[model samples]
Target: MDWTRQTRFSDPGRHHERLAALRGDVAAIGGVVRNLTVHYRASGIDFPPSRLAEIDTRWVSRMLDLDHERFGGAPLDTPRPIEQRLVGCCRDAALLTVAALRAHGVPARSRVGFAGYLVPNFHVDHVIAEYHDGSRWIGVDPGVDLSDVPLTPAGLHTAAQTWRAMRRGEIDPSTYGVGPDHEIGGPWLILDYLTRELAHRMGDELLLWDLFGEGIPYSRMEWSELPTELPDDLTHLDEIADLLIAADAGDDAAEQKLGARYAEDSRLHPGATVFCASPRGARYAVELASVNQEAD
Candidate 1:
């Protein structure tokens, strides 16, 4: 139920057990319409997709039957933001899929970003569910409604679709057709690790580590960089690290310039860093806090 973990997916065994349960639960739901709402409430995870799916699939469906009619319907004729349409559709699908997985006892989360391939600059969105399947985190894409939308993971609108392919042991992340969005770096790397680990559990060859391409650039000298010997308590170390990176990158002004986008990610130790060699040594480091904080 509480999928959050400080260790993330460090333990593979627990991940697998939970994932299998979720798969079975989702499969039991049977149909698109029923799976979204009633099935979601029965499942039990508390998140956006779950809550949203309950409303749309159950309340909204009863009132409107959006799944049969609204989904895949023509875009609004009046001039409006495409972002709104993309987010609305993807959000609905994600909530439905997430609710199904969580109902079955699998810890899952929803992810959204540009489709990166076919849509190019446009956001061709999709949702992927992350669940722990005992040994590791697994990914599933319930968004692939094969009867109506023939999913080709190789095409540009592929993130959500390819996620399903990965679940079916049909594809790998790097080759999943669409390029990743700009922000799917470390935090996402951890997220994908969970997703890919689940894929591996299903006798799938896909591995998250293998998919790390010229991933988003990471600065090698963030302030939070800690000594390899982590502290037993692991307290203010994270905050300290954040400050260090902000300082090293130079001054409050510089840190401010980088903004929350980098601030949220810049998870590294002040003294050490991880560089992606294949991506030509893109470096990443932690942030800084105060001087008294322990480096570890």
Candidate 2:
């Protein structure tokens, strides 16, 4: 469990040397990448198929290739036009930031969770980089444009936290989703993301839309038909949430149990291939690279 080592998703491959431009600067990540959906929408333009295809650049090497192709080895902090930035989401941003940190010998990992700071009164499903700052892990939002005034750092409301809150009637399920005005958030979303949270913690940082396991849903359409009521694998999810919560709280035994469960249970871990429910309306199986635990 060497967080400083790059996982398959974060490995920079041939671009490993260029990550030195980042030099573990999390704040500078915003200069090199662009939020795919936010970019097109903010510009009041529709996404061409090519821009949409960038979302499939799951590995950091591919993303770096795209960036190098567009910007030609510019320092990651170099300012660029909005259209010239690399297309990605919060997950990709976190992946790149983690890769940069690890390249510079920092113990960094991506956390798949929900964040309340993206939109007012809504917890958007988001990803952020968590690095060990000597003694404790500190979570920070990656990809902040150096142009904007720095905002106060807010905490990431993890999927485990959201699930526990929903079960306790502490928050509205409808408020947790991708965007503010969508019929997307619910217990099903939490269940799906909890598995994501688990995979990320286990070093399998995957795409946000990639769904694995037997019962996981591909999209909102599949998620809709599933029951909205309690007790359909709610107990199982609750167990997972508790383990994750305990592990985060410095319970070593809980961490060990959680790791063993992930290695043994295919339901909680991504297999060789996962179903990619692309945002552009397509579902296809994408293969995953095997983890090499001994690499470091």
Candidate 3:
């Protein structure tokens, strides 16, 4: 099925229908792989370790050379300002991954959650996939490649750490993972808003949000009223949080409300630093480094 153009969430039945489609598609595609190996003996068809590493991190252009070559001097799938275009770029990548895995007969589904990284950026988490390798589901991130560069200690940690932090209230549901308000418990208003806006932008294609699945946290609370105790050694995060809130409210008063805190905290902590201009996100990464460092 041409999932590239088809809406994956049109009907409630679509989800199950897609799974069936995937099963059938995998049976067909997996056959192709077997045929290629058995009939053709094309040893080159196999994914070399080096190539697999490349696939992991090429979703976004890393340097100027990459930007010029891969994305034509623009970020993928958008014709707007970078920040405003993030959701679309990310959603498209998610959809493409689903289609790619399905094409290969791998049962895959997209997931949204916090993906802590070593660098500071506008985005703190990632929305990737969990593919069923017949017996179990494995997290598959096609957001960016970490093959060339060593995985920073912060990035090296498993997704489970972020998961545990979310469940334990160490991380805020909103602004941690998928969307501004999505938590580990369930979807929140922010996701609803972003999804709706995206659907509208894409001419009504909400299926992208649920090609495999859309993860909403189990619960949520007002950011204005978080617990007194902060996550790990981020005692000062509260001050930054206040700044983020202020930044979101209006930038007229503060030149560097959200981005300012992010940049400062990032410099203060010594971890991996990728070239991302999102100040709020960079600061959050620094906060994570502080926690890991303290624990060490």
Candidate 4:
């Protein structure tokens, strides 16, 4: 299927009837605004932790189907526009944007990467939705709009782009990562996002905290020593990086090849468990097999 087409996650289906209901004027929305009331907050800006805890509903359909009461907000019977919604996370915003675009027959897909502009000397882990506008794929950050920063086709640095840039010494590896208290973004983080983004392009868009590879933990800081226990064949990353770039450029053949390669790569394949972080910063793992069975 084409990247623009909706999957189980992106498809709003009967939950939200029209794309008009989801559209928001980007000019009016600023970058720093966040939904303080919701349990899940996905920004550098902080918010009070929610009193109640629950598993994150990562799917766009599930997000649309959710009631305001679910997040301790006011009740709403139908889907609301972006301005009225309490979701400010990049993943949520990107998914909604993709759903809206796909509803209007636009080819769009969500991308996971790092944004350097968000923090000085740091590349924060971020996700954005990109839509093909006949000529090319343009990145759009639905979560925040830094009006001061000029927009361009390559404004957002994708994982693949970052990896290549880092390899060429164009950007410092120490500058790419998440969290303010510690160093998280580096070669490891870039590689992780690169793998995840590759999986995302192939329609296996796993949750933010989903673990891949044998030794890589969900949290980069958790590693006692950086770059420990990594795969012996790290050279494959260069090929994966090239494949991802090709896939992003709308090369269907490259995407299919990537899907096959990704599946065969034990380091990139979906693991038996997924690490989930709670509102209170508690981390736990869900058995992927059991979760799939329950979904089935």
Q: What lDDT does each candidate get?
A: 0.32, 0.72, 0.32, 0.60
Candidate 1 vs candidate 2, lDDT winner? 2
List runs of model 3 lying over 4 Å from the truth.
1-87, 118-123, 146-167, 172-296
lDDT of 4 at 77: 23
Give the winner by lDDT.
2
**For every model shown, what is its TM-score relative to the native structure?**
0.28, 0.86, 0.30, 0.74
Over 1-296, each residue of candidate 2 has an lDDT whose tens digit, in order, gives 78899888889988888886564555555344443123323355566877866766678887777777777877656666666666567788778878888988989888877776678877777887787878977776655442221112234678888788888988888878878776667767777899899999998888888888755544334555766664455576788889999988889898899899888877788888877776766667776763221110
- lDDT (10s digit) by residue, model 4, range 20-105: 34333333222212231131444233433432232255566555445334544332324344333454356666776777677767
Model 3 lDDT per residue over 1-296, tens place: 12233233211121223223333443332332122111101122344333222222212112112223434534222233332212223333444445445544555544443444623431344444445656654554444522211112233222233333444566554444333333422213223323222222222322222211122221123333444333354334334333433432444354244334434543222223212212121111112111112101
Winning model by TM-score: 2
Q: After superposition, how far is residue 59 of candidate 2 from its true place, in Å?
A: 0.5
Give the per-residue lDDT of model 1 (tens digit) for 1-296. 25432112122222233223333544342233233322222234333542332222111122122322434332212232222222123334444444445545556544433233344333333344445567644444454431112223322232333333334465434432223444333223323333332222222211122232123222222223423332244223333333423433336663453333233433321112222111212232212111111111
Error of 1 at 51 (Å): 19
lDDT of 3 at 227: 46
